[model samples]
Target: MQTIKNLVKDNMRQYGMFIALLLIMLLFQILTSGILLKPLNLTNLILQNSYILVLAIGMIIVIITGHIDLSVGSIAAFVGAVSAIMIVNMHLPPFLAVILSLIIGALIGAWQGFWIAYMRIPAFIVTLAGMLLFRGLTMVVLKGQSIAPFPTSFQKISSGFIPDIFGTESIHLTTIIIGIILSFLLTFLEVRKRNQQTKNGLEVINNGLFFAKLIAMVTVILIFSYVLASYEGIPNILILLLALIIFYTFIMKKTVIGRHIYAVGGNEKAATLSGVKSKRVTFWVFVNMGVLSALSGLIFAARLNAATPKAGNLFELDAIAASFIGGASAYGGIGTVPGAIIGGLVMGVMNNGMSLLGLGIDWQQAIKGLVLLLAVGFDIYNKNKSS
Candidate 1:
């Protein structure tokens, strides 16, 4: 019993927000009389918050490096406008337009990274200027209007679902099969990881606790798959998100560049003295942000089936809030990709739940603000307590 308590205490920071997320979902599920977890609403929740989740992925990395990009919202808008012109106005192929838009996003990131990293400018000032600059550019490109009726092919980026290969009408067999495969894969990976830890003389959690965690994870995945399969099967956006999460989580956990990022964030001067290229790391981080921001813009525009001048408004705030709530510390050098993704879901669920309850947008905003504040406060409290 004491060992179990010790384990929980040790992992509180890592698992706390995840537990909170589950609790929130459960509360909403009960309050909405089981409406919150319905297949259709669940699908809508994923589609609606896809862009914010994308932004949170990038934003968490930025925060990990002790920087913030205020201009992501404007950047997304600018990219969307550019893509709209290419696809809707000039009749360019959607694939080509997407590729070009991503390149443009990378260039924008490099521009900001150059100023903040090489030129020694503060990120806040640079991104603030960029926010205004790109917003104006978006307006100028759209001529203060909106572009509509994007090509069907482009629209599928957000609205499309993976087709059922089994051709079953009642349930999506492919989705369930995929979920089963994922469950086995996850179990294998966890067991192997535990074995490796033991082999390397690292501390391993109690066997019972570890197995319990594995069961919980597999159950969640299977249940999620069943829900989605019962509706329209898995969404293309969810696949993209899963891919991004897996790739980023690997990069942050296992790669040399990932370690460099954390080192630079933890202490730039110390990292520089130890042969880490702090400036280069910072520059590339922003460049990565730019690409993701652009991708987010594309997704948002595709979902709307139009590019509006006001598109992507306040996106930066949502992404930042998601990052912090997911456990990215304001002081830098502490965060995880999964944490950010979970944070985004928390916000998404809240928005969906409140909308179902007929709450006004004003109240939603206030509640979100309070949640963000509390999340940051919790981080600070943990830091002070550790000290």
Candidate 2:
């Protein structure tokens, strides 16, 4: 019993997320008459949640730095508008348009970063103003209208699946193969890393902990891969999104800069005293958010095959909800990439399930509101308990 307690304490963050995900799934499965676990519905859940996941990652970083970005949704709309204009109206090459739009996103981030970091303005006010400003700007750019029927190639960024050149029909063997290889490779690397830690005289976790984690990961991957492989091939956007998740997870886990960012979020004065460049870190965080907002915009436009003035309505709420639901603190200084991902999935699943049941949108939103309140309440409780 003591060993089990110690094991849980040692990896509480990981286990907490895993347990939360399972609990949520179970709750929804029971509520939705088990349709929540159906393979088709699960696939839909992933696709729907993909965008919020993108924004949640950015929002988590922003929140980690003790900052809020109310403008992400507006930025997403603006970026989507810009991408549509560049590709469809201006007749630019799709790939080049994408690249340029990403730069524009970076520039947007730089714009907000400058005001917040160098100007010493409150992030809330800046981002709030930006939220409104960008929404209006998006309208102007889109001429108070919606632009649709973007090129097929561009549309595929969000709506298309990986090509299945090697498949006979109905299944993409390549995707399954990729999933299997990826699963084993990831497992192998984890084992190798732990073995290295043991050799270095580091405090290696008990073998039980390692096995528990591995079993959890393999189960998740196999289930996810099986669902996707059974669908219309793996969604390209999901693949790209997963790659970004892995890359950012590594950045947060393995990089000093990532640590500094979190420290700044945890305690600005302490981090500054410790020789950390809090300003630069905050600036980069916003800049990174901008870039993601841009990518999200392009993907949104592509997915709808239309650029609407309301492209990212309420996206800020979704992103914030994802972060907190994933275990971020309202006061900042905690949260993980995987946590944000799970949070996104949680919201995604709820929305998908509610919609499938033909529940009134009002009820769907009411439930989400209750969930958000509960999540924030949990954070406060945890924070006070720790204090």
Candidate 3:
């Protein structure tokens, strides 16, 4: 009994979000009479949420540092507009424009980061000012007009799927093969990680419990692959996003920079006293946010094959809400990439499901708001109970 209780306590955080996701799907699936889980529709869910998921991953890091960036939406719009202008008017190469747009995004981050990190201005104020500044700039750059018919090469960023070397349309055999390998790789890594933890005398869960989680994870992945493989081939955007997740996850989980971020979030003064370059960390976080924002802008632009000053309106809200819903503390010092991904996906799936059901936008907005509230409220309740 004690072992079971302890295991439950240790596993609660991991299971809570999973349970919420399942409950959501069940409720929506039942209400919609099983329309939400159709394989093709579910695949659509992944494609739609791809951009927000990317933003949420970056937003999670920002919130974890006891800060927020309110200018992401405007920055994305502004950068996207710039990319569009370069291509449509200036006749710049699409790929070159993409690079230049990203550089501009980095510059925007440097501007805001300088204020927050070096001058010690509050992040909210800095980013808010940025929001207004960039909004106006985007409008001016776009001339209050939309740019359309972006290069097919650029449009493929969001609309394209991975092509099979085998040249078949049913499904990419390569994708299936890759999926199988990934599952096994993931399982192997988890086992090795748990064993390493044991060797290091760290508090590690029992082998059986860990293996159970491994099985659960791989099973879900396989099921998802089966669904997507049954329809279109793997999405390249999804693959790119997954690569970003893996790279960033490693940085956060294994690198000193990641440790410093958490340390600063936990207590900035303490972290500074411990010799962390808090300013640099904060600066880089913004830089990263800027880069990801640009990437999202491009994805959205590509998906639509158009760029408008209003393309990413209110997206900051989505990113911020995703972070908080995924267990980011408004007070900082808490969040994870996986949590952010899950949170973003929850919002994404909700929107997709509602759209599939032909629900009005207003009702969809309300439902999303309620879910956000519940998530944050549960987070607070959990924190209070633990404390």
Candidate 4:
């Protein structure tokens, strides 16, 4: 009993967030007369929020390192514009255009990193300049017009679904199978990790609580899979998102570089004294952010089937909000990729639910602002209380 109590105490924030998400979903689900979680709506929710989720993934890393990237939205817009020029005007291959766009994003990262890492400019000012600069460049490139009709292959990056292999006319069998496999695999990994911890004489969860958690996870995945199967097979972007989540979670929790990033974010001078190349870590983080931002740009453009000068407007805010709502510390050194994803989903669900209720844009904006404020306030309260 004591072990379970201690475990729950230690994980209060996570549990709280989980419950809050469920409550919000339930509230909206009721308000929308069950429209919020309908099969089609769920699929739309994923598509609508995919870009924000990608940006949140990168933005959390930036915040983790005690920095911010105001230019992500503009960078995404700029990259999308470039992709349009390459594929539409130059008639370049869609594949080549994507590769070049990502490379261009990396170059942009290097440009900003040189100032931030080596020249020691404040990140806020640097990225603020970047935001204006990229937005201007996007306008110049697009000439205040939208470019459209991208190649079909490129469109699949955002709008396609996995081909159903089982040929089940009524349901997507492949999606269900994949979900079951994932649930089992995740449970096995958790149990194995617990055994490893015990072997190393580290604290381990009580077996009963551990199994309970596993059961909860399995149930959620099965339900989610069912929802997707009822609509269409798993979306291509969903697979991309899952892969990114798994990869980043591993990097942040298990890798040397990940530790260094956290250390730098925690205390730059102390991390430097410990031989962690703080500058290098910061540089690579921005580079990673650039790549992700570019990827988001491509995905957004694909989904819209066009590149517009106004594309990605206010995207950075969504990503930042997601990071903070997901429990990223303003002071850095604390956040998780999965948490950011959940935060993005929360925002997405709210947007979808409110739209279904026919709320005005003004109301939506105001409500979102309040939600962001409360989320940050809650985090600050928890920090102070813990201290």
Candidate 5:
């Protein structure tokens, strides 16, 4: 009993938002008369918010390094417009366009990073300037018109699905098989992690709690897979998102650069004294953000099948909200990739749920604002309590 209490207490910040997410889902599930969890609705939810989630992933890293990027939405819009011009006007191949767009995004990141890192410009001011500059550039590139009819191959990046090898009707056997494999893999990883901790004489969670966690995770994965399988199977974008989440999670948790990011965010002076290259780290982090912002723009444009001047408007707000809601600290140096993903889901679910309930867009925006305020407030409260 004490162990369980301690576990919850220690991980309250990490688990609090997750539990809130479940409760929110449950509330909407009842309010929407069970439409909230329908397979089709669930699938649409993932598709609709995919871009914002991508931005959230990048945003969390930036926040962890004690910075913000207010220009991501504009960057996304600008990149989308540029890609449309390449693919639609110049008749470039979709794959080539994507590669060039990502490179362009990286260069934009480098531009802003230079000012913020080397020139000592505040990120807020520099990115604010970037926001205006890029939004204007997007409009100029599109000539105030939306570009449409993206190639079928490019559209598939957002709209396609993985084909089932098993070829079973009425259910997606491939999704289920993937789910089972994932469950087994997760179990193996958890056990291996526990073993490593034990070998190193580190304290391990109680066996009962650990097993319970594993069972719960596996069950959730299976049920989620079943839900998606009942519909049109997993979307291609979901696979992309999963890969990104896994990669970023590993990077943040395992890599030396990841440690350096945290160290720098926690204390730049201390980190610099400890041999970390704070400027270079900050520069690279912004560059990475630019690339992600570009990827987000591409995803949004692909999903819409058009590049509009307004495409990605207010996206920076959504990404920032997700990072904070996911448990990233305002003061920097505290967050996780998984936490940011959960935060994005929370926002997505709320948006979907409110729409289903026939709530007005005005109310949705207001509610989301309140939620963001509360989430950040909670973080500050926790920080104060801990201190």
Candidate 6:
């Protein structure tokens, strides 16, 4: 029993943010008279937060590299403008326009990378300059007008739902089935990982604690899935998010490039000496950030069905706040993809909840600022204690 308690305690530190998210959601659920988690609102929440999540994912990588990109929001706007010009003005196919937009984003990233990684300019200065540059360009491209009523196909990118395989008129059978499968797969993976660790003579969580975790995770997955199924079913944006999460999580946890990234962030001189290709890692990180920013722009434009110069205003703040709140160390060398996701969700929920309560935008911004400060303070406290 004591061993299980110890296991739980240890895991709690690692999962503290997730716990906070659940508690926050629960509080809002009750305060909002259960409107917070209603199927339709839940769906809206996912859609509303999807672009921020994409940016957060990319921002986490940049932060982990001991660097920051101040221009993601601007880049998103620029990319969205380019997309609008391509699809709406030039009459390009939506798919082709998306491809061109992504390419442009990669090019923009590479341009920044050359300056920051190759020329050795400070990332802060480089990205700050980029923010202004891109913002101006977005304005020029948009020409002080918003382009709207995108092609139906492009709009569907963000607004579409997955086809129900079971074709049920009521509950989405496919979503429920997917939920069950995911639950089992998650449990199996956890158990397998623990077993492998044990085989390698590494410490493992107590069996009781492990089982409890499995149950909790499975329950959450099932419940969330049910909620989606009860609505219009799983969204296309959610699927994109899941794919990115899984892909990045694997890259960070299992790949050589991932290790090099952390090593570079931890100590650039040492990583270089160890043949970690610090410059290359830094360059690629920015490139990845660029691509993500572009993707977010596409998603945002699709959702709004418009390309506005103001499309991605202050988005960098949301992404940066999310990354930091999710456990990314300001000084780098510490963070997780999952942490970033939770952090973004925390911000999203706060915004949604505040709006629901009739709180003004001024209060929302102030509250978010305070939350960001507190989160960074907690991180610093932890770092100090550990050191």
Query: Which candidate gets the maximum lDDT versus the true structure?
Result: 1
lDDT of 4 by residue, 211-323 (tens): 88899899999999999999997999999999999999889999999999999999999999999999999999999989999999999999999999999999999999999
- Model 3 error, position 266 (Å): 0.8
Tell me the number of clashing residue pairs for each predicted model.
Answer: 0, 0, 0, 0, 0, 0
Tens-digit lDDT track for model 1 on 240-345? 9999999999999999999999998899999999999999999999999999999999999999999999999999999999999999999999999999999999
Candidate 5 off by > 4 Å: none
Model 1 residue runs over 4 Å out of place are none
State each model's CA lDDT, in order. Answer: 0.96, 0.87, 0.86, 0.93, 0.95, 0.93
Quote the positional error of residue 157 for candidate 2 in Å: 0.4
**Candidate 4: Cα lDDT at 198:** 97
Q: Which digits, one per residue and each the tens of the lDDT, describe model 6 over residues 258-307?
A: 99888988899999999888999999999999999999999999999999
- Could you tell me every candidate's TM-score relative to the true structure? 0.99, 0.95, 0.95, 0.97, 0.99, 0.98
After TM-score superposition, the amount by which residue 51's alpha carbon in candidate 1 deviates from its true location, in angstroms, is 0.6
Q: Judged by lDDT relative to the true structure, which candidate is superior, 1 or 2?
A: 1
Q: Write the per-residue lDDT of candidate 3 for residues 1-387, one digit (tens) a residue.
A: 677698778766656676778788888888888878777787678778888888898899999899999999998898888888898788899889989988998899889999999999999999999999999999998899999889888887898888778877776676777789999999888888888888999887676777788888898888778777777768878888899889888888899999999999999999999999999999999999999998888888888788897888988999998888777887788888888887887788788778877999999999889988887788788789989
Model 1 global lDDT (CA atoms, 0 to 1) = 0.96
Candidate 2, pairs of clashing residues: none
How many clashes (backbone atoms < 3 Å, residues ≥3 apart in a chain or on different chains) does model 1 have? 0
Misplaced by over 4 Å in model 2 are: 200-205
lDDT of 1 at 265: 87
Which of 5 and 6 is ahead in TM-score?
5
Can you write out model 2's per-residue Cα lDDT over 186-293, one digit (the tens) per residue? 899999999999899987668887898888888778777877777676888888898999999988878998999899999999999999999999999999999998
